[model samples]
Target: MKFSYLGDDAEEVSDVLTRCIGPVRVQKPLNTALSYRYEFIAAGRVAFSRATSQGSLSIGQKGEVPKLLVLLPLHGAARVRIGRDDSLISIPGKAAILDGNRLSELQIEEARSHLSFVIDQGEIFRHLSAALERPVHGSIDFTPELDLTTGAGEILFKLSQIMATCLGDNAEIQELPSTLSHLSEGIVNLLVDTVPHRFSAALTEGEWLPSPRHVKRAVDFMHANLSAPISMTDIAEAAGIGVRSLQEGFKRFKGASPISYLAQLRMEAAHRDLLNADQRLSVAEIARKWGFRHMGRFANDYRKSYGCPPSEARRRLPLSDA
Candidate 1:
């Protein structure tokens, strides 16, 4: 999940950049001696990268890019060209969002230091489809520019900085697979909610609050799939309603979102398993059985819900139950 490369050879730098970033054709490779230092970390369909190079690197691609890219320059600047005529310069305190299904060129200046995030376009669309409770056929139209010093863009920048710092520090939480998965989706969700995209209006528009029958349907579906990796789209499909409607219904009826309701169910299920499960099954095993993947988070939630930890909950149960 981590990659680092440092070299002076142009071809090797190109190869390393291609491997770390994406498929890129380096221009003027034979004439320059470059010192390129790059590090990359990836989780699921999302990736973070840092690059510092002593010499300029020009890269261009002929076909569509596979992942949506966000570039944040820390020092120096990069000239970016999307499609044919749309071009911009990415410097410090600014971020550039590049679409996945577009031809692009990048001009990295000497002594440039920047951090970039890459997210798979397919995964983005899949999450979008789930939020919409329907299939999405086309790519999102995102505003190419972001002022990273203020507003939601600044929050996103800070989040990326924090995540990169955590990953770089080899933090204990870096090993959390479920956390990583959630982080990826959460980042996409934030971008969708805050960024100026084609679907922003549709996503923000209010939906009709469903009746009690629909709310009951969603609750029943969630209870039936407590341990399953079901998404909002699945719950909406089961309830015969849109995701927005289902969300409003859950809020009106259960005072929570569908996901939160499902989490509550899963937590109760975990508590029940802890109380009655065989002593041989550890708290972790019981948690996993009820779809809790991150043990730390599971334990924390368990304590909050039961006024005690899972182990204590299990120990307090009557001997006959055990």
Candidate 2:
């Protein structure tokens, strides 16, 4: 998977990392910090972050949509706060889940390190609902006392292995979706089997929410034709829904507008090509290939979204691949 840094200073990077992984130890009290790195895994739908701090750090606020933020501490203990609740979660193999749509804060003292993985909550829930005999609902808390031993541990371990391998190999970013989906399915199955009782009542309530198959199909179509001049109408027609309905459906199901989602998907595709293309394609060529005609506008949007110039993204591609 391709990696990109969003901040220029070490402190800024630490702050982003803290938000991403909760809290971690910091060594020095300096204003300038390293930039945060975002590993574009699973076609950019999922990402993994590694944060290190010499001193103390903290994270505040919630994400725009619901996501699964999983933290695996690599060093020193840190304090995590969700709303009014707080806990001292320690390091090495310890994990915690925080809801993406809630107000939460995290504070890490000096000298801490951690890894965080972001997953789509809705996707996980849908998979869980299918695996279990009944529907699954409600939020999940990742308390330290909760043991992942019953198959869950194995699944987590496997996921961690996959993440490590992907990062270590500098894997192609395009392969992320399938890779992540495979891992997600395994984890969902484990969760269903181990946390079955926790969701029984919600299942009884008939709140089983299955993502429409069309959404996946739409995603596939968008990915396949990302370089083409596709529009909302095309997507809607492909999904067999009217434009308005399609927009609404995407918002409700995917937590993003259709265009925004398409942009993100296209950007991921372009980024992958930029990183792995053998010909060392020009930025204009890449942008045009990805259906971006206006160089200036594309460059601006790219920087805003990915926090780097398109040229930088292209430069990051493996030299051998280029």
Candidate 3:
């Protein structure tokens, strides 16, 4: 889930960049020595990367970019053009949102370093559809420019920083698909709610509330299949309703999406197992028994919910069990 590349050969750098990012041509300044470094980490549907180099470079898109990409410069400015949009310059406190499926070009100056986030476009649309309680058909036209110094943008920037820092420091977290999925889902939800996009107005003007019966049914389904790989569609079918209706029912009555509710139930189940399991069961085993795939994430979530790690919970078992 992590990759690091350091080299002076522009051709080699180009090949690596193409593989990590989309199809692109990286050109070095004529007769100038180049020092290029790239570090990347991907978790679930979100990916973060850092690019640092000591020479000016011109990179041109050769094919479609399949994910929504955000570029924030740290040292030098970056000029970016996506599709036919006007070129925008990104500095330390500003960022550019590049449309997926669009050809683009980037110009980076010397001593350049920047952080980039690549989000799955399909995931974005899925979240948007759930929020609107309707099927979303096409791509969202997001404002290409984002100001990182104020308001929602600042919050987003901080969140990205925290995610990058935590994931970078604790490599084991990367292996937890569930944790990474939740993290990516948070980012998608934030973007759909706050970022200026074509669907912004529709999202704000919605007023579709499902019945309490539907919500109850969905909850029952989630409880019955707590250990199964269930989807929104499955929950909806079990509730005798549509997927969007299920989402609305949970939002209106439970104040949480169905998926979030399911996760909460699973977390509580994991907590109970941690407390009740015999000494033969390790914390990791209890976690896996309840569908938790990674110890690091399971411990973190357990601490948040019970004010202690799973190990601590096990150690506090009753004298009879001990």
Query: Which digits, one per residue and each the tens of the lDDT, describe model 3 over residues 134-210?
Result: 33434577888888899877877876775666345556666677876777777778777888998787666643344
| Model 1 ranges off by over 4 Å | 166-171, 207-322
Q: How would you encode candidate 2's per-residue C-alpha lDDT over 1-322 as one tens digit per residue? A: 3454444454555454444433323233466343333433332335565655555556555333345666767677877776666555655665666665455666766667666666655455566445432223345443433333335654675566567566544455336566655665655555445543445444445434554766656777787887788888898888887888877766656557788778766776676677677665788898888888789998887765444577876644221121
What are the clashing pairs of model 1? none
- lDDT for residue 61 in candidate 1, whole number 0-100: 67
Q: What lDDT does the true structure give each of the candidates?
A: 0.74, 0.58, 0.74
Reference-based TM-score of each model: 0.63, 0.49, 0.63
Full-model lDDT, candidate 1: 0.74
